[model samples]
Target: MSLHPMCGVFVLLSICLISFTTPCYGGNILVFPVDGSHWINMKVLVEELHARGHNITVVRSSNSWYIAEKSPLYTSFTVQIKENLEEFFGKYLKNHLKMEREGASALTFLKLTKDFISMVSEGHFLWCEAISEIFDDPNRVKSLIDAQYDLVLTDPAVSAGVVLAKYLKLPLVLNVRWIPSGEGHFAVAPSPLSYIPVPGSGLTDKMDFMQRIKNLFFHSIIVLQQKFVVGPHYNALCDKYIEGGCDVFSLLQEADIWLFRSDFVFDFPRPTMPNIVYIGGFQCKPAQPLPADLEQFVQSAGEHGVIIMTLGTLVNALPAEVAEEIASVFAKMPQKVIWRHKGERPSTLGNNTLIVDWMPQKDLLGHPQTKVFVAHGGTNGVQEAIYHGVPVLGIPLFFDQYDNLLRLQERGAGKIILLADVNSQTFEQALKEVLHQESYRQNIERLSRLHRDQPIAPMDRAVFWVEYVMRHKGAPHLCTEAYKMPWYSYYCVDVMVFLLSAAAVLLLSTLAIFRFLCCSRKRKTKDKQH
Candidate 1:
């Protein structure tokens, strides 16, 4: 009954071909990303997962559907929501722009906290409604439930993803685009208010007593708002949609992993839990050859090098006068300028300046001739600049931008100019100092080396952890016990209170005993005299 030699050879070759050509199977991953930087920041991780043979489905707005559709690597599903979050962001930015134009002082730390709370609250409700609409459609819900995704990856900035995870019974992971801030503190390890600055407070890790008090005040206020106001709103959404009462804070606390877009090299030293992974330069890639036109302009400066300026997608247009003032400063410098502008071209743009609607920012920064980056201090822009060892001239607008620039200045890798204070002269001086200072370049270059010195690239680390979670089914083992402790217990407030009360009681008992002894002795002496 033995097979012929030719038949056996044919079977062996067929098996080998199948093994070589068949795609390896990885677990299914569902991503729920909001618009703008949150969406852009997750692009690299998503692409990497797709490349590694994982099934990824991105649920985003129709406006950005093309982002997921452009690549056959993944599937994209679009939902129609009446309220556009970007429009709200645009309005908010306009208010800041107007204030800057009118020369208002930079937002105080308290004011920034209030503004941030409002922004998060508004976005939470808007996205909740949008997500509910997607789930309300019976067909979409059925399709999603049938898919039975292995894991849910999302930006915790919006809580809709939490509800979706609950609906599908999937494990959740947060792809935080910045250092763990206000709400993020609850999810990761507990960061002490005494040292860790409240997000957007613009305070560094090193703080005096007064600064610590201010940080405490702001942090407490934000926590209160999240607990009382934002948490309830998200809970209501969960109740209506998922038939379970889950709030934003609780969902964040339960997340299996928090992949923060930060590294200790760029950030001040702070304690992080095992579940918190620092993948700061996840989006950074080696520079590709510049487009022909961009190469010519960048090369035009030759020995002088080039300065690249961008305000990111959110802050596209500056005030007319402000734009002109910035342009004038570029004109004064010998370096060639590549400015990413959205509105009308600045009238004062110099011959050495090239204005484009958009540019490949990472590629430009990675270029050898890239001397300095003039940016709005967005997390993506700052990280890209740091990855490429380019010093920054940060003109902070709002949100984490102020804190990011403050950190850069502390590191001596960059300088900050308040948008309100950005006139031609100040801009020129800042640019000149960054370009001329050898310390700026040296420090950033050292940091860049440290950034890339890890055993695995940040994106690879991200993909590995994602697959780890899928394989382990939620990774509850990695979660810290800090999440189980109540806030007061975690900070040892109750322990401190008990110790203080015990000391007070002991002092009172000692004084009472002394007083009684004194009274008894006086009575005995009086009786003896009688």
Candidate 2:
């Protein structure tokens, strides 16, 4: 039965309306990062999303892998350096050394290095430039969106992708890598560590008087150095990438949802904006059996069991002194120690100490012989530890590590030691306390149960929300309206109350002046008549 032309037109109109109104299969997510910490979560999310029948295309940043692949010797050297350091630290600091705390310091050193490296080298800047170029290209993003799929989910690292989303005028979901950028303000209302100061405080209360001055001096130096030393190089890189101006921060504000890879187990600030959602600890899965070698090592160590120490991926290297301190502590401990380091150790290792450059941390943590985690307190590490119901001795280095570990201690899931003065004795004491204390283990167990009891795994929740965006016309409901208003309007005190108050003051001042002038003239006339 061939349809008439009129009937065909009606059928076509119906299809168009359904396409507009009905939900799409949850659209493709463009995740960045070649292969590192993001690999675990990103893989889990993409796989789970696919399982739920959503299409996903991950455009990995091949930068790190490329470097390693190109320079095998360098990579090996890096690994050797790490392993040596782990051995040294484990053997020396075994007395009472806080492995996690030292781990934190190591992390800070790495971050400090990254800051300097980014300044000295052109690699990261060049990558940014390349991204900017792609964004600046005409209709590149629009073409991609039009070719297939409905919304775009991006990590904040892809500042260029944010711009692309803006250009395409599509809904965007920001998959928060760890802590949201401005979460210090959100998590702790009166946070003193203000990178971007809140208004009226004059950037004064943002830091102590000395720190503020130091920051100013440091910023001035950086700006001057950039102008003289780094700016030209960066500009060359920028020239290669960005054609037109773009605001990366603005793109963050424009995102439809800021989905955090965290749970209430860590930092649970009451949500100020509807768009922010905490879905942390989602990547942690139930424990699987350890490999034969690791299992054998644990078995050989006997009844006291072993402590697992890792500083996470970024801070594989440690200072020699710190490394030695860790090694010294491990030498004194009766229990076996497994340390992950990336340097050469000067000290001799005891039979109880196992120093390796890398360990399957989750797998090790899940081991029945594993008692405590000595860590740098990265969210990923913390979550994994918690999920395994293991307590941590957190040595926070910098960034959110301090805050993250602090919260852990507060939650009774872990304890913290200052990174500045950590030695074998202190590290050992902290470790002994963590291992012996029943509360630490019990507290973590409670957190672990709560973490596992979530209605669905984090991946499922993440995928569901992503799909929800497509089903509900870009998840308009998830978007926050806070950015739409001026800062004053957000509190309903700026334009509304402030203007009203100003008007009242002006009217009162005018009336008073008029009355005063009238009285003065009347008094002068009366004097003249007299």
Candidate 3:
């Protein structure tokens, strides 16, 4: 039977609609991504770019843990670097946890900071060397130059991408949350200590005097780290490779766009730059069918519901005692627990809990049976919890975990139990509160609705901005000239001083004139009297 004329018209219209809605792809993109968990999100972007028909080339360190040497998503150009920092990071996490257990004494605090600074310095040094090697290799350098990539996309946590982008003179886009110096906004936006809290400060946007003092001190430490610790390594590379030596902070600020991994829903409101695009929870989606066995476990909870716990991949597991305490609490709970734990099994393991190396985190959170998330408070985890509207009982470990959880707690969507205070009593109480409280669920669900109520999906927004940069060649217009200005000039301190000086000089001249005129008048009166 022949198709009706109207049916043919509808099919043709559908094709035109589909074509117009999607972007024409095949832009050449060069990705220099930081490995480990950073790679997870970067890979998400790579996949989307690939689907959009873009050609991508990723630079990977030979010692990469999570990033593979071979991938269908993108081809990797591996650089050999001695010493795997993952092992160093693992050891640091263990010792750091041990120190926390010992107590937060001055000595322990100093030791922890010293180790942290050393690890940070070492990681930058290795990558700086790797980028240096790439620069020295005539053939590879030529190949990169010849490729004529439209832009350089990187995670600014490591300074290599920022530097490499400068060296290549390509438009740069940062998949940024943390820069080498500090948080992304501190470099690219006008962040005031009065309101915007520095990371690691443990202060929220609404801070009192003492909290502001703490925030200032934290800001100072970040500046010191930039100046004394990570700066020299990249500065040396910059001096050698690029015409004018550039600091990591400056290079980071110069990026055409920042695909910020946070949204205002998750982050406290503060100053932001136009170039920064908030793509938080972009990796999230509707839950797929759970693996058969995992589905069975989740279903077994029945009306009680399931509690999902995962503390990220950085640490193998919490110290045995902490784990035992947590496990015992899970055992007592009516909710079935699915925990991603990878050490000696906790002695208090209960039939209600399932221990696994990994569980589908996003899937679990999206599941209706999942009640509360017990997490380490990583950005990905916290944002995912908010995305799924799952209330969180956070046991923040290190880095920005505390601050991430603090946002949730501030919003009443989550509760935090510090590692130093993670005994069975605290863990059990916190878990019970989150699991039973209707308010927590309501707040988070509201947040989820707000997150979904965007004009466009975050993933599409990210890809659009990436292609935006590619189309525009560079987005210097969107970038602030503030980075190029020194602090005194940027804050208009010179202008302030100039205005104050002019006023002071005018006042002095007027006073002098009055005194002289009064003296002359007095002399003339004396002459007349004589």
Candidate 4:
């Protein structure tokens, strides 16, 4: 009878634990996502949210590149766009690559800056226009207001999501790495220019005097760009729709939680906020079995191991010459190579290499036989490499790609070969170094161990916060009110000024008293002598 009672108690405890541990409650969530490679990151979260039984509705552009109008993951809400940016993006990337390859002359630098500003300004305006169209339609506005969503989940790289969340007055959650201004931290946390490098400055955390100056210059440019190039469009939207006008940066700060996509393993240690959840490698999971044919190819590598290369989703292939050079270098190697190239086939491609439109990147990285990963230094690729303990041989193309690789290089986990500096000789040499060096693998594996040592998986932690926001409606207590303070107040400049004035007044008063006492003593001594 005693044993039976104990067993019943154990069973009851188990049931209660199971109920609390899993996601059992369903809430309605509205997600506004950015298009392009960013959608890939957002989709992972959406899928996880759906599996937990939350009803999801995604707002998408009519000509969205990666997002499908129809999906099993979520119901799609399509909005019209003035232009599909694919053509614009393709041309812009090609031109940018051409300029970069031309070298870092003053003229080249100016042109690149001009092109970048144009892209940023135009992209934001188009999104603002799309959102404006949505607001203009009474039925659409009524539908959204009636939805009674638990929260608005969005990626803030584009301000559409941020602005929409503000308009809806829903509890906001951000899937963020970059905002329209620059890196997300600049808008939310304390980032000292001396140590915290500005994105695209290509400087690391440790900097000499000149490097610090460069970091500051880049930071200024980003500020100017946000104020002049990107801010006006969103500011207009806010003025028109919001009861009180808001700025993009302010709205981002108001978010209940920020699912930061980076961690110390792949990024420099910087000041982070309480609401900022570091879910760096949340998208990564253990490798699954490769497709039968792909596995056969990987297995054939045997002693030499395999090399996997992909330039991410944006570019189809390198310029023909660059592609040919990279292909030729691969040909000379004994290791089998898998290159994801979507453009014209390179004539120099070797029998050892397999060219495909896409490969199972995370799976390939996790494969034990995989020796080296050649990548574009994208955030996804870098984080995946860390998860799989694969040493990277990075060829950075554009936009923070170099910065991402630099982090790995600094830690001795990877090496970077600038796209402008690539040739068969240099490419082959870098490849050989990464392949033969054991330290690279050892260092990355160390990172992998550290990343995995956490008590809870990053994905579970991410889901918890999302649900926490749903349950609580918002997490205002965790957020700092620092964003609302004026620059002088935030920096304590006014306090410093007041303290200095008080010290000056005290010093002057003491000096006057000392002079008065000396004069009095002289007069008394003269009278005594008389």
Task: For candidate 2, give the lDDT.
Answer: 0.63
Q: Over 4 Å off in model 2, which ranges?
A: 1-27, 33-35, 66-124, 135-146, 177-246, 491-493, 496-530
TM-score of 1: 0.86
Candidate 4 residue-wise lDDT at 42: 92
Colliding residue pairs in candidate 1: none
Estimate the TM-score of every prediction. Answer: 0.86, 0.70, 0.96, 0.95
Order by TM-score, highest first = 3, 4, 1, 2
lDDT string, candidate 1, 264-351, tens digits: 8888887778888889989999999999988998898899999999998887889888999999889888899999888778888899
CA shift of 21, model 3, Å: 4.4
Residue-level error in angstroms, candidate 2, position 102: 13
- Writing each residue's lDDT as its tens digit, candidate 3 over 1-530 gives 99999999999999999988865857999999988888889999999999999999999988789889898988888998888888788888988998877687798789888988999999999989988888999999999999989999999899798889999899999888998887989888988999999999888899999998899999999999999999999889989999967667778878999999999999999888889999998988888999999999999999999999998978778899999998999999888999999999999999999999988999999999999999999999898899899999998888899999999999999999888888999888888898888999999999899888999999999999999999989899998888888889998999999999999999999999999999999999999999
lDDT (10s digit) by residue, model 2, range 70-93: 221111111111111223323333
lDDT of each: 0.82, 0.63, 0.91, 0.92
Residue-level lDDT for 18 in candidate 1: 92
Lowest summed lDDT window (length 10), candidate 2 = 73-82
lDDT of 4 by residue, 424-487 (tens): 9999999999999999999999999989999888888888999999999999998999998999
Tell me the lDDT of model 3 at 273. Answer: 84
